[model samples]
Target: MDPSIVREIHQIVPENRVFLDLQERYSYSYDASFGEYLPDIVIQPQSALEISKLVKLANQHRIPVYPRGSATSLSGGSLPVHGGMVLDMSQLKQKCIIDRENLLAIVSPGVTTAEIHRKAEEAGLFYPPDPSSSHISTIGGNLLENSSGPKGLKYGTTKEYVIGLEVVTPTGEIVRTGGKTVKNVTGYDLTRLIVGSEGTLAIVTEAILRLIPKPPARKTMYATFAEFVTSGVAITNILSQGILPAAMEMLDQQCIRAVENFKPIGLPTDAEAMVIIEVDGHPLAVDEEIERCAQVCKEAGATSVHIARDEQERDKIWQARKNVSPALAQVGPTKISEDATVPRNQIPAMMNRLREIREKYQLNLFVFGHAGDGNLHPTIITDKQNKEEMKRVEDAVSEIFEAAISLGGTLSGEHGIGIMKSPYMEMELGEEGLRLMKLIKDAWDPNHILNPGKIFPQPGQTKVVLTDE
Candidate 1:
């Protein structure tokens, strides 16, 4: 970058806030994705006005700006492949309640998801979206990508929880959409449009999210299955029996072992698969639901089941589930998590194909996710240095995606199709859909200044812009 631009940014913001050193820039280069590429500059803005000035400056210089939250992303969504400025938003972390009686919390984009949940808890309210990365991921990025979690089974995804948005347009124009009211049938629904734009449309500055009353009491259970298919079947049976557990997660043999190895949480290592189910409601209602769920699991071929005798046992049951990603990371440095979701009843078929893919690729795999929602994160751990082995893993990923599409599923359940899945996007959405996406991208960013080289591909391109230009 020219020294003039750096000087201008310093004039607009501050020297200490704008990071240009190679070492600091290197740290900001990558997210949770396997790929890494440093940005030309990383600027931390403390206010929307600071960001407004920075965005306009970057646009005037024809610099691609990558707006990042907590950088806990898996799809390289936060990677600045264009070598332009990365507008780090973690500094814009201020949060305050706009109106509590109206159940609205006004928060800056950089606030962690976990903080929002804790705030809601204090107010006798609840925020349904709880991504596993809630402790690290920001509310801004969650709204940007429309992230989901186990709560999605009952409360829907982030987009559903978002009622309004405050966005900084590519040209530095600030705008607001939706409002405090629930049934605002307002114009355009841009709030919904930008909810999952993945930082390509605009940078979210603040959000007005909806909150529900937290459940009274919760009970968690562990259902052990001799067969993976049986666990999937048990999930289907429980949902069909009208026993809506607070959360229903399934872990295959590989996931269980990986978690146990990482954190010895006293789980049955011999079980082929384990299903962690939870119910939260009135004491009497929960007891009845638990009994029904247990019966359904038994009928669906569970080898054994354990209902928590107390809250202590309950925490132990969930500890294994919580340790999944870190545990899988212990196996290899590069952990690629795929979010392919099929229909509720097709989970058995999906799990079966997953095992087949793991065997065919001959790689370390961990499969676990919200079984109630049919969203499974089949993680593949590998050493990227081995080109030939990675080729096999790529083939296996392609096969798994094909199976998902064949079974009426999309490529991503929560994680957006950033650069990671851009190559095979046409296989799923085809030429016409790709053109429509391009048209939308062009409408939003006529100059292609917004986060470019994502979602869609230009023909004959080697990659989805893997390096800083």
Candidate 2:
């Protein structure tokens, strides 16, 4: 960066908030995903005006601006792949107000999702998008990725809750999109557009999120299947019977054994697969629905079904599901997590294909995700340093995407298509569809000054390059 540009940036943000040291720049290089690209500078601007001014400067110089939250993005959404300016949005975390009357929560981008959950619940309300990394992930990242966790089976993704946004455009103008009202049909839905845009179009400074009354009562149960594919059968049967669970999570044999090994939670290691289901509503309705769900699982060939006797037992059941990632992490040094979704009916086929892929690649692969919505997370654990193995891992990932598209599914369910999944966008959307998306990106950021080298693949880049030879 030129000294003149550095001086201009310093003028926008105080010297203390501007970090130019190599150590500070290195800290912002990598995210939770693969690859690392150090940014030229990191700036923690306090206000939207400051960000607007900085973005304008970036556009004038054609410098890439990467807006980052807690860097918990699993898809490399926050990685500064172009090595320009890194905007640490975590510093703008002062505002969080719950508007109970309107059922809305006005919040700053830096606030963690878990804080919103705690505040909403305290106000006798609920904000439902609960990603696994909610405790650490900021609201900005969740909004950008439209991340939703296990509960996404019943509730929708982060895009559904976001009603409005205070955004700094790519070329540097502060603008407001949508409003506090849910039924806003005034113009284009820019709020929805920005929610999952992955920060290419604009930078979100604040957001207005919709909330609902918290569920009063809930029931939890887990069903084990002798065959892994039988778990999918149980899921389809439960949903077909009109029993909508708050969350329907599934884990394969590998995930089961891994969790049991990591923590002796007494999980049924002998079972080939397990499905955890939870339903919430009226007390009587909850009881009836839970029993019905168990019966459906049994009819679908579930080896055993157990309903939690109390909340403690319920948490224990969920703990087994929550322990999956860490448990699998113990299997290898590198973990590649992919969320490929299929239609509910195609889940069995998808699971079969995943099984075949796992065997073909001869890698440590474990599967789990929100079963009700057909969003399956097939994670591969391997040593990236093993060049030969990484080549196989790359091939396996490509096959996973192809299988999903063939089954009328998508390359990503909740995780955004950051650079990690950019190459496959054309495979899923076709040439024209991808071009139309690029048109939107180009129109929004003509200078390409915001979050460059993301979502769109470079020329001749057909597949992810995970290994360097």
Candidate 3:
């Protein structure tokens, strides 16, 4: 709120992009996390140069700046902590260079993941990482979170597809890492490090993403199980059989019924769990794999298996999965979704223990996620305004994190340990492990102004030495 800082903001970005109006600033106060923190100012920079200038001014004054793209994150990663300024990246949307020969594309941070997919399809190439929030989440936010979607099991996550980056570090120094070319390891893989820093390391300006040829054929299969464990067993059996599916997802009966309310997609209503598997390749190859997967599903004790006959049916199947998030959300005004991932083989045990917790806490919880990779999104729906209920939800979430670690799993699979998971990070990684993290963070961001109060806990609260002796 300083006069000089206000002047610098206007000087950097155009007057039209800067909003000092209280009502407008109030609108940028929260994200999809159901959390709120009103920022004092909101800046929508039109270009990378403008962004750098604003960052410089914010850092100089030690004002907290939260970088947000679409603000569709599940965790409160984009929520402003100290309430200074929010750098809205949505206005910086731009996509160019659909280089088919190089199999890559250059895009601004504000570009949505789905936008890139549509553009890439026009160029006959494919950019594969498809987070469930692809329609609303921005490319920069996806990079910061290292988001993974259904196809992540086969194509890999954001870290694998990001070839290079043009990022502005916390000090407002714009630095470029990597290039359009793929497969380069001349030194430390800093590009990968920045990929999932959740905006704490830097503000990604633009990105160069790796693209592969679009698959010629894809077949989808849905199987219902009498028991949830059997569904999980099917996932492990398929992978153990050396059949890499493009996507293998699972949803318990509660999740299925939620989706069935508004639009019935022929999903088994009485089934304990359901598994949706997709295989893609050449026509002959895809067909053979689909048949092989069907056999594996049966061996794992599936009650019935249904394979989509055409593209229309395929879309319908995915539609159900896409709506699964919103469907489970209806249980309460606020949905608390956590990403607890165990190894593929341990998925059955994880799912069983989750059910036990739900019964113990008397929670009406619904569980679903990418079963192929053992990442589950156990959603706890509750009215955030209900203080008593909220406390119970918090305890359940803490226990869930501890349970995941006890199963030899980590706290998060895709969603980073933002403000929501930072407190519980020690449960998974002890003080010694966290110490090493802080050392690296301090080396890059000495001021701790960029997306401060994220990833790790506050200073003095952590045993991690910020200095290199």
Candidate 4:
């Protein structure tokens, strides 16, 4: 960057806020996802006005501005692929107010999701979008990805709770969409548009999130099935019986064995599958619902059903499920996690397809996810350094995407389409559909200076190629 450009940026933001050291720039190079591209400069703007001015400067100089939170994205959502200036949004942590009267949370982009959950619960209110990385990820990242976790089966995603936003548009204009009220149908739903835009549409400075009353009580149960297919049947039966569990998570035998190996939890390693179910509401209703769920699992060929009698027992059951990620990390050097979701009824079919793909590719693939919502995480554990093996892993990944699309599902349920899944955008959304989305991007950022090389595929790119260049 030119010295004049740095001087202009320093004018907008203080000299201390602008990071130009090589080592400092390298820290903002990559995110949780694959690949790394160092930015020319890194800026930490604390206010919306500062960001607005910086964005205007970016447009004037045709520099790509990538707004980033904690960089916990599984997809390459925050990677500075274009190698311009990276705007670290984690420093803008000033606002986080709980509007108890309106049941809303007005928060800054730097506030962690876990903080929001803690504050909401403290006020006797609830925010249900709980991603696995909520403890570390920022609300800005969650809003951009529209991420949700187990509670999403009933409570919905981050997009549902967000009612308004204070955004810096691509053209450096500060705009406010929606308001404190939940019911707003004024015109274009810019709030929804920007919520899941992956920072391609605009930069969010602050957000107003809607909240609901916390549930009074909850019950939990765990069931082990002799066969994976039977576990799917058990899920279908539980839902069919009108017992809408707050969360219905399933794990394959590989996951069970991995967990048992990592930390002995007395889980049935021999069982083909296991599901942990939970229900929340009034005490009596939760008790009855959990019993119904246990009964359905038993009838659906579950080998064992364990109902939690106390909070400790419930936490024990959840602990086994939470151990799956770390346990699987022990299997291989590389973990390619894909969340290919299908229709609720097609979960069984999707499982079958995954089995075939695993056997055909001869790769160590483990499956688990929010079964109640049909979002399965088919993670492939392999060494990326092995060229031949990575080829098979790439093929397996492509097949998983195809299986989900064929079953009338999407390429991603929670993870946004960063560069990793951009190739398959047209496969899921036809050429015309992808074009319409590109049109929206073009209209929002005419200079294409915000988080380029994401969500849209380059010309003639049709498959995922993970091998070295």
Report the C-alpha lDDT of model 3 over 1-469, residue by residue, as the tens digit: 7777888787788789888888998899888777677888899987788888888887788888799999887778998878888999988857656888899989899988999999999987888999988888899999999999889899899999998999988888889999987988878887999999998888999999999999988999899999988888788888888999999998888999999985787788899998899999899999999999999999989999989999998898888888888787666787888899998888888888888889878887888999998889888887777777776777788778878888899888998777778877676779888888888888887878888878786654432211122
Estimate, for each residue in 1-469, the C-alpha lDDT of model 1 and write its tens digit: 8999999999888888888899999999888887787899999998878888888888789888999888877787888977898989988857857467888778889889998999898988888899999999999989988999988888889999888888888888888889887788867888998998889998898899988888888888889888888888788888888888879988988888888889887777888899999998788899889888988889988888889889999888888899898898899877888898898888889888988888888988778999999998888898787777777777777777888888988888999877787777877788899789878878877777777766665568533332233
Give the C-alpha lDDT of model 4: 0.93
* Superposition error at 448 for model 2 (Å): 0.5
True-structure lDDT of candidate 1: 0.85
Query: What TM-score quantifies how close candidate 4 is to the native fold?
Result: 0.98
Full ranking by lDDT: 4, 2, 3, 1
Provide the lowest-lDDT 10-residue window in model 2.
228-237
Q: Check candidate 2 and list the clashing pairs.
A: none
- Predictions in order: lDDT: 0.85, 0.93, 0.85, 0.93
Tell me each candidate's TM-score.
0.96, 0.99, 0.96, 0.98
Residue-wise lDDT of candidate 2 within 118-150, one digit each (tens)? 999999999999999999999999999999998
As for candidate 3, its clashing pairs are none
What is the full ranking by TM-score, best candidate first? Answer: 2, 4, 1, 3
Number of the top TM-score candidate:
2
